[model samples]
Target chain A: MAESMTETEQRPSGVPYPGTPEGRRGTGDPGFAPHDGQEAPELLERSRALVDPAMRAAVESLPASMRRIARYHFGWEHVDGSPAAGHAGKAIRPALVLAAAAALGGPAARAAAVPAAAAVELVHNFTLLHDDVMDRDPTRRHRPTAWTVFGDADAILAGDAIQALALRLLAEDPHPAAAPAAARLADCVMELCAGQHTDTDLEHRAPEEVTLDEVLAMAEAKTGALLGCACALGALYAGAGPEEVAALDGFGRQAGLAFQLIDDVIGIWGEPLRTGKPAGADLAARKKSLPVVAALVSGTPAAAELAALYGKPYITGDSEGIARTALAVERAGGRDWAQTEAADRMARAMQELARAIPDPEAAGGLLALAEFVTRRSS
Target chain B: MAESMTETEQRPSGVPYPGTPEGRRGTGDPGFAPHDGQEAPELLERSRALVDPAMRAAVESLPASMRRIARYHFGWEHVDGSPAAGHAGKAIRPALVLAAAAALGGPAARAAAVPAAAAVELVHNFTLLHDDVMDRDPTRRHRPTAWTVFGDADAILAGDAIQALALRLLAEDPHPAAAPAAARLADCVMELCAGQHTDTDLEHRAPEEVTLDEVLAMAEAKTGALLGCACALGALYAGAGPEEVAALDGFGRQAGLAFQLIDDVIGIWGEPLRTGKPAGADLAARKKSLPVVAALVSGTPAAAELAALYGKPYITGDSEGIARTALAVERAGGRDWAQTEAADRMARAMQELARAIPDPEAAGGLLALAEFVTRRSS
Candidate 1:
């Protein structure tokens, strides 16, 4: 694994990683702002404004028993059922949908894709709820996870209901693309389930037994599939042809991979105050994240040292040990590998976007969104 | 609360209840044969023959990680990845879909409805998988449940995937009714979630704090909603009018309640050999089943005694205590109330079926299915 990624290769200190409040990325773009005068943040804001009402209406249709759990999960309500300033994610998926729609078919297509946008957002949250339960995640968006507050059964039920509601939105839409969108979205859910299974299954396996390819496939399914489907659905709504839809899907998938790579890098190196967790929290949890796995398989002297550190369970407040492990990985070229791979993936994403839209101006919104996603925490 | 002839009202032995090999019901009509030359079992058999292939094909489409769990849950495969003599329950929901279609629009409609039939069955099994996880059920279809074999996370993921597959089937179908069916099925899923929440929540509540109406509504939501959706989907596929679809939904809902009522009675009184559980197993588990809740809420002297017995948890090997508890519920008129209510629900189901299809000959299959469901067990 230590091919060109040797200790001599280096990246700048500050790289973009996902900056979700929960220390993890799920449904949204989080709190990132416009950079380099890009329209990505503005586009995301517009997407959220458009999608939130539809999402709320869809959530309202859930049975009262499940509605409370869902509302709280969405950051729309407190545990006591009182209203709250919603901190629902930055509508990255919805923004992708609308941007893709507009890129190919202009504003009318964007307008027509609103329900599908909401549907994608709902699906994202549904996965978040279930993933929290499966991973036993205690917090999300800097608050107690739905499972922690409502218990496993309720969390699971709420996720199930939300997923149903998501597909129902597409199923009920009068748009000609609705059925196809539902089908695509449903396919994405299966991919996601399989991805989550692979994820949890990998966590149980010995680190040496897992390949980098396996990790990449898992990340692609877990993180890339939905993003790709969101763009694909938008293309369908825009009356795009098969090739165009496929290209847009490719674009989103590569962008999503870039996002995961950056996110994983940050998990090892991001500031504790920003990520809302202790530095190297993934390391402390013994999570087989991208860089850690990359470092372990690097076949260098430091790879052995990193593996030795990973073999032992993390001790609480063992900052010195964490620092040593981080140094070992850096020496083994894991950080450099991740950053290089992320940049490569982003380049591929842009190529795919251009392949479908040819015109740079038409693809600018999507291009900006993709860049924002890869920057300092996608 | 019971205000009937008290303990004087008695049901004869051998009342037909759902005779699934598993103690609980979810997907199928189970292993009962035709009664009085009724076509219910025959219809279920044919429906299974038609729908199983579609169901299997859809399940085969799941990712390998989830496919094994689903195959095992459906009793198509064993824990070690070996094939089993498939004991997938009687295709009651699929049978309902086909029978309702056949009743309203003949053979063409029935054939067109096959995909919907499979979709309904998939949804049913999806719920079964998740319910097994949430309820910590050890066995299903007389085998170890998916969760017991694969662990909680995999089972949950498989369930999630199966639900998506169900919606995908509808979404991909070219039939005009597909969208409406997906919408209704999605709504039913939400209702099922709410119902399951109520079921678990009620189980945690004190016996005296629970009410009969609450249990009834829960049963309707949890059990009846899916059945109703199955029938409604069938109706939609048949190009039936709103009134016909509504009537079929009502018909299935009432029949499902009857099914639950009979199932609850079987819980209290069925032979251990038949139920694959100890006598009064539900009582031992302190489940707030329909009859038990009715007894608790009954304003009778025996109600107090039954409540007192229910206040304490049952000990393992305490058959005598279980018997005593069963008798207390019986004396509180729980058995009579359940049987009478089931019969009444069956009558209402018949009324709705008649309204939907005035010609008795045209409705024979549905009539038989409803009768089969409500008989001693549903």
Candidate 2:
């Protein structure tokens, strides 16, 4: 059993801390010690050490300038070229990949860890780069956007390069499911493009023109598809049965949608300083976020006034007005509605995992992961 | 032997005729023929039969608006959906793909024909779409550009969709080398992107600021890489030996470069009515064409006057002055220099093919193919 665990359990080194509650901060120790709540930390630490270099090597294969951008975006560098190594993200997406593979009966999941980790990270960063361009905002994770640093053309290329790298890394994996995983990843990428197209189109529309269902559809295609891909690829590496893959896909889809809902909520109501953003940032931009859409549909007096305000071009000092509108959404049950939906999604994800995993002990970390994503501040 | 022939021989297309001999008048047929010196009408008919539908399928994979613009650009439809097919292009690129595969050796080549043919055709169209955008040109072949009909965003997306479809089609091939070929195709795509970046960058630089070597490097990356991908992919599908693959890569690269040089010549000196373009188009745009570069280097009085003329910003009637400049290039032996270089490249390409392929009969068609590309009009 010990030998089997050595072969089957691991996380990438940049993952910081795996399976430990203390390391959940977006920043902390670069040294990760993966644990199973009861398992020895040394065993998990060794696994992470083996995977980290591989992840870096895969990322380094990209074009030099793009690699530099990715390195910075991943929080490995400060703007001034110093080694900051701030919060490098949760690594939850890749963890899902490795855990799903293990839950499925494949021992090859350990070998897949580096690529699995790198691919998800790349996908996340690709979105960030493009979203920054589309949103026309300057900073990300407390640093200048790649577009801001390298110019829009180079930033576009950087995103393109990272997307290509993700596909290439997955292709290079020796797992039997590499081909299918690649096709799925490509499909996910296309979905991202489509979802973004719709989002851009929506930006020009009136507030009342947007709907909750449309927001959900956009969220699924833009965010959920990639998360689903991560889980499906993990299952693929594990040689999971088709049923298991399907269940995990469902789980990931729900979890991703829920994640987006939480993000939307935070975008409107989270504390500015803690979020490293201005209050009511999405509202100030007149973004058709989930809660805003919900409020529009509710037909309250506040909704009517908000619609009137959104009809005009917002000027300076209008952010406070948008925050007042967000408050109306809270009063109108939009926040409550969003939170309920997230809880329902979390329940669905857990239920699917229960059905697919067979071994409940392996799933504890995933359950914690789901909670972490839904409730975390940053 | 019958089966082997079936594998290795492309039924010759009738005759190659594109537009008209006069270049200005529009002709329904692009002067397509069966094969060189072979008046097999069935071969021409079969080649068309194989290429047209596959090209349609490839274009249909794009988004609807993109498909509409692409169809109009291909001369398959008017902006309002009126019938308009004959003047689009000769589909020569796809024909070359099939011919190269058949000229190698394998029954599998026949199975690979549609996809390999489609791949090259899509790539060619992709370049045309982006070239139209980057060059800010209004027409291609003999009709309005896709961007003229569908807007820049749609045109860009159409080009992107074509690239994706080309790679996807190649990936679906069942040959053992298909995976490696797909990888090569992806690498070529990155090169194409890099070349476009370089071209866009050069747009802001003065003619004196652009170096000859930079022009050559950009040409190789943008044009030669895709052409090489087409040839190498065809050879791989045909189950050709490693030597043949390497030979095809060189053949494609050289042929592509030579083709570009002739294109530069035509862009400056060809009759506008015949070429469906303004005479001295490149010069009018103050483009850093080979002849222009030669004129810059020749140190003649006429060359200096031409440089002065090129130094001024171009307006509508500047094409006449550009033509006079092109005449200066001919007097300086630049046109002759370029033609001789083309011939040299063709000879070198043939030499590589000869060393790689021992079958004289099979080698004959490939060499003829090179001649057709180097000397092609319109």
Give the best candidate by lDDT.
1
The TM-scores of all predictions, comma-separated, are 0.91, 0.81
Give the best candidate by TM-score: 1
> Candidate 2: lDDT over CA atoms?
0.63
lDDT of 1 at B44: 83
lDDT of 2 by residue, B1-378 (tens): 123222111211122211122211232322322234322333334556887787788667654545676687778888898888564565655655665676785435845666777767776776677667666788677677887876655565555555555655654555565566656666665666566667666666776677767776777777777777777777877887778888888878877777777667767776455456556777777777765676666667766776677788778876566667777777766666566555555556655655555453454445556555554444
Best prediction by DockQ: 1
Q: Assess candidate 1 and give its lDDT.
A: 0.83
DockQ of 2: 0.20
| Candidate DockQ scores, in order | 0.79, 0.20
Q: Write the per-residue lDDT of candidate 2 for residues A51-77, one digit (tens) a residue.
A: 456557865765554567667777777
Comparing only chain B with the true structure, the TM-scores of all models are 0.90, 0.82
